[model samples]
Target: MAYSERLAERIRKALTHLPIKEKKMFGSLAFMVNGKMCLTAGPERMMCRIDPDLHEREVKRHGCNTVIMGGREYKGYIHIQEENLKSEKDFDHWVRLALEFNEKLTSS
Candidate 1:
């Protein structure tokens, strides 16, 4: 599968109250809120577009990694392994963080 349907379902449930739009991008299923990128579910993993200020601290978390493309690190973006999302708390953390950042973007 290009992306994790299971993970996508989980994300869908989490954001059920919000108006979310899904699209296939970067070989993943991207969740967009307020017309901005929020999260993406890929093969056995997910990516979050969070606040750049939290990048350093968040990358230190278990199974969390800064997103890198072509050897360049993308701050405020991270890939989270599915293993770390086994618990609802962990999963909610990422979803909340991504939404918070997305909200900030829309507000500004």
Candidate 2:
């Protein structure tokens, strides 16, 4: 298994309690909750989910780049750096965002 696979597995284990599913996408794995992408990992170094309404702000705040695929920038999704995942608190922050988005999306 590649590093990404290991990383994905770790993330999967961490999020097992959440109502989410993992799928292969962009040569990596994407975590979806309620049919919307909440997290992604692969060639990209990080994983994060952004609010579509505040994507730009979030991106700038994190100093991260937008995920662009097939000539389109995937709004509301930000790539997280592996270095940022060193701490459980940091990882949990992103997870919280994903969960919040999932809950908001499902409630509507």
Candidate 3:
């Protein structure tokens, strides 16, 4: 399944307040804010960068599972289900978390 263009557009609009840059990466679209990768949308999946310090908290809060690719679990990233993204509020929350993590890494 391919990523929905509508979903991507909605995400981009919601993130207008942030200074973010979009690029093609890993055959998908990546949103980088402040030079750190924040969010990604690929065929059938949407993921967000997780802050190492708050990984556990975020997982628990959002029920997000680690992103598994190529037979390994990629830490510091979570795959968000499409169903959860249907609501604007839900999508914003995920984007906000990604932005927060990106900010922390770039500032530190």
The lDDT leader among the candidates is 1
What local lDDT does model 2 show for residue 67? 79
* Highest-scoring model, TM-score: 1
Give a tens-digit lDDT track for model 1, residues 1-108. Answer: 689999999999998999999999878999999999899999999999999999999999999999999999999999999999999999999999999999899997
In candidate 3, stretches whose alpha carbon ends up further than 4 angstroms from where it belongs are 60-63
Q: Model 2 over residues 45-106: C-alpha lDDT tens digits?
A: 65677677877776774437787878898888887776666678877777787778777887
Give the alpha carbon lDDT tens digit for every residue of 43-99 in model 3: 656788977776766666544688778989777788877677777788888888787
lDDT of 1 at 96: 91
Q: Give the local distance difference test score of model 2.
A: 0.73
For residue 60, model 3's alpha carbon misses the true position, in angstroms, by 4.9
lDDT of 3 at 27: 67
Estimate TM-scores for all models. Answer: 0.96, 0.79, 0.81
What are the RMSDs of all candidates, in order? 0.9, 2.4, 2.2
Better of 1 and 2 by TM-score: 1
